[model samples]
Target chain A: MTRPTRPQSAPAEAATSATPVLELRGIRKSFGSNVVLDGIDLAVQAGEVVVLVGPSGCGKSTLLRCAIGLEQIDGGEVLLDGSVVSGAQRDQQARTRMGMVFQSYDLFPNMTVLDNVTLAPTLVRNADKAQAEERARALLARVGLAEKADAWPNTLSGGQQQRVAICRALAMDPEVLLLDEVTAALDPEMVHEVLQVVLELADEGLTMLIVTHEMSFARAIADRVVMLDGGVVVEEGGPDFFEHPQTERARAFLRTFEFHRVGR
Target chain B: MGAEFLFQGATIQRLLAGLGVTLRISLISVALSVPLGVVMGVLFTRKNRVLRAVLRVYLDFIRVMPQLVLLFLVFFGSASSLGLNFSGEVASIIVFTAWGAAELGDLVRAALEAIPQSQYDGAFALGLTSKQTFARVILPQALRSLLPPSVNLVTRIIKTTSLCMLIGVVEVVRVGQQIIDFNRFDYPMGALWTYATLALLYFVICWPLSLLSRWLEKRSSR
Candidate 1:
């Protein structure tokens, strides 16, 4: 492991809870004849960046969706911040405390970027409009697009839209943010810019679970890597797993995707 | 050409008075229908199976039954059976309003359902509650979808108001029939022109709404 030249920052306030920010136990889901998340188990500590990487149709997104209660688990439990999020003990409000960003950057096309970012805060958090706009502006600046606040989302580039979507997720002040293949939809040239913002968030010690195909992003940002295939965790480890994956499936999966050259 | 058929005092006065009644019924019925239609339309898309089944049955009954039959049932059949004593004009408004509400409700529901589920998913992921998400995200977006069908329903309601004549409400068409009743010997063209004027008035009332619907449809496509 490459050692940090400076002292690592303290974990975010969101991570200080006794319970893991998110925990899933034996999650199983299927679409009729097709089984998706088959008895998958994962836990994410507060302020930890957990990356779930696998080939398409491996149920990586489904697992993240299940974690957030966007999809009902056919079997098993999802717990967030020590409280159950789904099943007999599930509280819908607890699930709301976690935010999710989609690969498609599903910004409300009818709204301005500022409105899109501030929506949940104003509506659900009951923040006054002025405060919401102020926070939206700050988050927009963090994503390097302060001037794009009043612009419609359709007017922005793919990378810009994705970044705005990230800002939107952050606007909720969620304890955990789930990113499902956030950069996969960006152009090759634009992927780094979007990933750079995510890396910055990771550096700030935000607790995040990102499902990704971007191998280098998986390596540089994730404190822990969770590899999934055929609705199961094929392997789980640290950054080095990218270079020397243990499972045959993980090895084969990584071999198919070309990773960008790093540390030149 | 008989001088009696000419646009003199009484005939013109009667036409204007009939036009007023026609406009009043159309406006009031639409006012009642639009909001009712929107509510019914939204309710149709809800997940409650019992409500859905009930609404479906109600919508089917309304759709399959002829409007004229419904009008007679409400104004003539039910009014007499229930011993209510409203004048024909007031009964006409109530019957037409009910008809309009059911139609509009169906349109609202279709517009709500046509919206992609991903839109709701995207909003839910943002931490907005289902109610907030629907009110903020779904409803505004669905408005464009609702417009065209709503305009169509408005035109249908306007045309259907002619059925009021059977119940003895002296709307424009009824007045035209009265003129034909008196002047059938001298000039048949007087009634034809009167009916043509009524058709033109209906077109004037409805054409702008049709244009609005088209414009909304075009905008949403973008």
Candidate 2:
């Protein structure tokens, strides 16, 4: 058996000085009396693929949502290219630069796949209709869904709907893409098709922040793996972090997943 | 004996003229109420407590009172107390429009609420402004859910127009009663045939609306 190797990019050490494409600084959020994210800091430099892995209720999804201004943060701020994009400064224009795909693949049921993908670009960016449709077609074709464009969202399989969702996000030409457990709702068989698309995006050097429960896929795709536990970063390292977790908490978390050595 | 009076002395023409009045009342009221109801519905969804409280009071006031009471208030009370002289037709329109707007407003609110929260999040995540989300995403979907109920409301409005004759509007039912009284002895079965024809007329108008509502329900569910 063989496993595909991750495409290498610029070394993380050299990319430190450059402004991150998306940044979360000392982010704090709570629901009612319960705190979900507590003063957490993380960044994804241009073209970096950062994967967030944590147990249920650990706030990985909340962090991704806050980064895109979906959930209002109680404290701290989010930044895009070093400019504050959170709190009062957050606006539609600022949010447009970040794309997000959810687990449920929230495609507008009222629209065809092409319409779903073209909607944001034409509405938000004021892009010309003909040109936006052309770009949308190209994005859909790239995701192996060119033929499905005329079909209503409900007509497609779950995996296909998710692929169209990715196409919808990419249509915005976002500076950073956010994936929130994109495959959590998929059947075991359909997960691969969605993961494959994300891997291709990674190879194309698209900057992304991903939260996933699939340990093997996380290890395969992450340039930097950040393990979150109890609303804080418990460990952060390269893919080698999986081989030798630095903290007991990280080690204990990894043990929960049955390890399958890739490329052994 | 059966429907013999229906052919006597411009009876058919008189009934149709009265029906035309009923339809005019219904049409004008529907046009006024639907747009007003839609606007009220959108406002109802907002988180403003004071606005909702005021609108709730208006909705409850209209709901608790009978349509007959409303018609009397607008037609007789206004003329006597407020010194605002409105014809019976005008009063009927005012009362029915108020009633339709309130009922439709609630239906619109329920339809809007039926939309999952994720749809709003999805639209927002795509960078659509709040207005854009409502116009392009939220409203189009809400309209689908509300269509069947709205059609049903239209039928209700048309049927309820029969009540306007009580206030001396002399609509279809009123015309039927006049025909039945004028031939009571000569045409012994006049009342039965006259009332039956009135029922048939109502059925003719509302039956298609009911069918349309059912059709819309089926399509939306699919």
lDDT of 2 by residue, B1-222 (tens): 367668878999998888899899999999999999998998899999999998899999999999999999999999999999999999999999999999999988899999998898889889999889989888989999899999999999999999999899999999999998999898889999988888988899999999999999998887
Tens-digit lDDT track for model 1 on A56-160? 999999998888878878998888777676875345467568889998988987789999988888887789999999999999998899999999898999999
In terms of TM-score, how similar is model 1 to the real structure?
0.87
Candidate 1 second chain TM: 0.90
- Residue A132 local lDDT, model 2: 93
Q: Looking at candidate 1, what is the lDDT of residue A93?
A: 65
Q: Model 2: per-residue lDDT, tens digit, A1-264?
A: 112554457648746678888889999999998889998999898888899988899999999988888889988889999999896647888989999999999999888999999999999999999999999999999999899989999999999999999999999989999999999999998899999999989888889999999988888888899988888999999988889999999988988887668898
Q: lDDT (0-100) at residue A51 of candidate 2? A: 92
Q: Alpha-carbon error at A238 in model 1, in Å?
A: 1.7
Which ten contiguous residues of candidate 2 chain A have the minimum total lDDT?
A1-10
**Model 1 global lDDT (CA atoms, 0 to 1):** 0.83
